[model samples]
Structure formats: C-alpha cells, structure tokens
Target: MREPSMPVRENAAEQLEERQSDRAYSKPVVVLDLLWDLAFVAAATAVLLSSRDEDPSMPLRLWIVGYALQCLLHMVCVCVEYRRRHNQVQGEVMEDGSGSGSGSGRSSSSSS
Candidate 1:
C-alpha cells in the first residue's frame, strides 16, 4: 500500500539550499572568518606541540602568551562586531516602528 506523501519532507532539500543562498554576510567576510578560524587552529596546534617538547620553559611560555593574546584580540573583535550589528538591528527596528524592546515581550506572550 502507498502511504501519504509529505510536502515538508520533499521540500527539505530545497529549503536548505535556499537558506544557504541567503547568507547574511558577504563572501569576503565569510572568507576572512574562515581564515581567522584556521589561524586559531594553527596557533592552538603550535601550543600543543610546544607542550610535548622536553624543554617546556621558553617556547611553551611564549606560545601560551601568544595564544592568550590571540584570544583577547578575538574577543575584542567579536564584541565590536556584536555591538555594531546590535545597533544596526536596533536602528532597523526603530525605523520599522515595531518598538520591540527585547525578548522579554515575546517570552511573556509565549508563556500565556
């Protein structure tokens, strides 16, 4: 016997493709993010390799310090990007006259 067809199941692949095509960031930003991720991985690998060395004094300390600085720099960059994006979104919402302050409004309604 033939079962009923599900449109949701059939359109899953199309939906995924559409979402991928509708990226928020540009290609350059995506590429830069990938490069930064690779750099972080390389730095972490260097730190791990340094730990395995018999002489773990100077080289290990330097790698650890460098990794720490990388983490701090990444955090600052993320914070700046987040603030910029947040302000941009707020500006958009303000223009739209929605005036949705935060998630608090949505959460309260959903609970009711």
Candidate 2:
C-alpha cells in the first residue's frame, strides 16, 4: 500500500491575521440584520395573535404597543452591541473600519 502525502500546516498567527481583515459588519448589513430580526418578531406575534378567533381589536392594540416596545429594545441592543464592537475594534492595533464607522461612534463602556 502507498502512503498519502501530508498537507501543509498553516501558521496560527497568519491564520489569525488573515481572519482579522473585514471582520466588522457593514452599516447597511447590520441594519438589515436587525430589521430581519424585528420582522421575525413582528411576524411571529402577528401569526400567534391572529390565530385566536375572538377580540382582534384589543389584542391588536396590545400587540402594537408590545411590538413597538420590542422593536425599541431590539434596536437599543443592536446599537449597544455594535458600539461595543466599535470600541474594541478601534482599540485593536490591527485593522479598522477607517472611513466607515457605524452608529454614532458614541464610545460607551465595554464589558466582556
């Protein structure tokens, strides 16, 4: 039987460096992701609430308030997450977004 040749091993530092490029999310992409998440929440709430046959008006009103609150909360969270990333990524000596910083660059405290 013939022996198989060994594959070349990649350097750990090189792999890490290579992975660092373009790691931050784009502004539009992040907004789109949050929008899709919000959309999912809205769709699920609508489907579940609508499935019940009685008193759509009151529940609909309640759902609107709840949905608005949920969307607000989601936006806050996404913004916080992005801000944290911005701070950490900015602190990093490696690459940065340069011309493209997202969501105000408000410099909030980071916890991890």
Candidate 3:
C-alpha cells in the first residue's frame, strides 16, 4: 500500500515565505558591493592623478606599482565579497531548515 501524500502546497508556501524573508537582507549586501566599487574607482583616480606629474623615471615606476596594488586590492575585495555572500546564503538555508523542522515538530506534537 502507498503512504499518504505530503502537503505539497503547504511546503511550497513555506519555501516562498522563507525566500521573502531572505530577500529582506539583500539591500545591505548590495550597498556593500557598491561601496567596494566606489573604493576601486577612488584608487584608480589617485593613480591617474599621481602619475600625471612629470617626475622623470620615478613617476612611471610609481604608476606601475599603484596600478598593481589597485588590481590586487580589487581582486581581494571581490573574493571577500563572494565569500561573505556565500556564507550569508548558507546561513539563510540553515535557518530556514531549522525553522521548518521546528515548526513541523510543533505541529506533530500538538496533534498527538
């Protein structure tokens, strides 16, 4: 004999609710991303301004160093943001799972 069917509609509703809750925190993440981009832009501007001066051979070396440093900083920022976003997503999934499990447990205990 087949087992009783699970409440698919209720499960879908719960998932939708969890996704809505997760989206509430998206604004801060977006703001952080924008801030990083702004910082990179500022670094590029500084490099350009400093290199524009006529300082014989030193300015060229300085410009090269500045460009390399800027590239490194930008890469680091991207990696950090990527890791932070990944962690946030994992945390949300864990929280959602725990919430659903506890809710189901409560419902089951109440009916017994």
Candidate 4:
C-alpha cells in the first residue's frame, strides 16, 4: 500500500524569503525596539507605583498623563516604522515587477 503525494498549499520558498526579509532589519531598529520595550515596562511600573505619590516633584496625575503621552508616542513610532517598511517592500516589489518592462509601472501609477 502507498500513500498519495500532495502538493504544498503554501510556498516554502516564499516563506523562507519572507523570513529572511523579516530578519534583515537594521541594528538600530532592533535596538530601538528593545528600548521601547524597556520604556513600556518602566512607564507601566511608574504609573502603577505613582498612585501613592512616591515622587514629590510630580503628581500622580502628571505621571498618568506622561504615561498616556508615552503610549501615544510609541504608537506613532510603530506606525511610522510600519509605513516605512511597507513602502520599502512595495518599492522593491514594484522594481521587480517592472523589470520586464511590461507597462506595470503605468498601471501602478494609474491605480494610485
């Protein structure tokens, strides 16, 4: 008795390529992500502990506000990074698509 062979539902080569591209982020971005992680933890800790007015210089309200602002800034940074990488990948894809000179560039422009 023999089992039937099956074709791959997902492309292994594309998955590998995507993984490689994902790992190709610059060192600074990775460092920034780590710093953001630390900042988040610190901000959360500060917000949690500052409910009792541990710091006399700043009020708990100010700490909460600062934490909220930090969260907004983090969101903005994430959005900017995502847009930057998305554009980079789109540009690369466009270049590759246009390599054959089949007027695909015109279609992209017209679609935009």
Poorest stretch of ten by lDDT in candidate 4 = 1-10
- Per residue, candidate 3 scores C-alpha lDDT tens digits across 1-112 of 2333357666667667755654544656655755766676677777677767566755565665576577667656765766675575666557668555545543343346
Which rank order by TM-score, best down to worst? 2, 4, 1, 3
Residue 59's lDDT in candidate 3 = 52
Task: Give the Cα error of residue 38 in candidate 1, in Å.
Answer: 19
List per-prediction Cα lDDT, in the order shown: 0.57, 0.58, 0.60, 0.60
Question: How would you encode candidate 2's per-residue C-alpha lDDT over 60-90 as one tens digit per residue?
Answer: 6566667767777877887787777666656
Candidate 1 residue 22 Cα shift, in angstroms, is: 12
Model 4 spans > 4 angstroms off = 1-58, 98-112
Cα lDDT tens digits for candidate 1, 7-26 = 65545655565345435344
Best by lDDT: 3
Expressed as tens digits, the lDDT of each residue in 1-112 for candidate 4 is 2333223323445456555655655546656775776688677767676566454665666666677667667757765776676676577567877557524443444346
User: What TM-score, to 2 decimals, does candidate 1 have?
Assistant: 0.39
Best by TM-score, which number? 2
What are the per-model numbers of colliding residue pairs?
Answer: 0, 0, 0, 0
Error of 2 at 96 (Å): 11
In candidate 1, list every pair of residues with a backbone clash.
Answer: none
TM-score of 2: 0.43
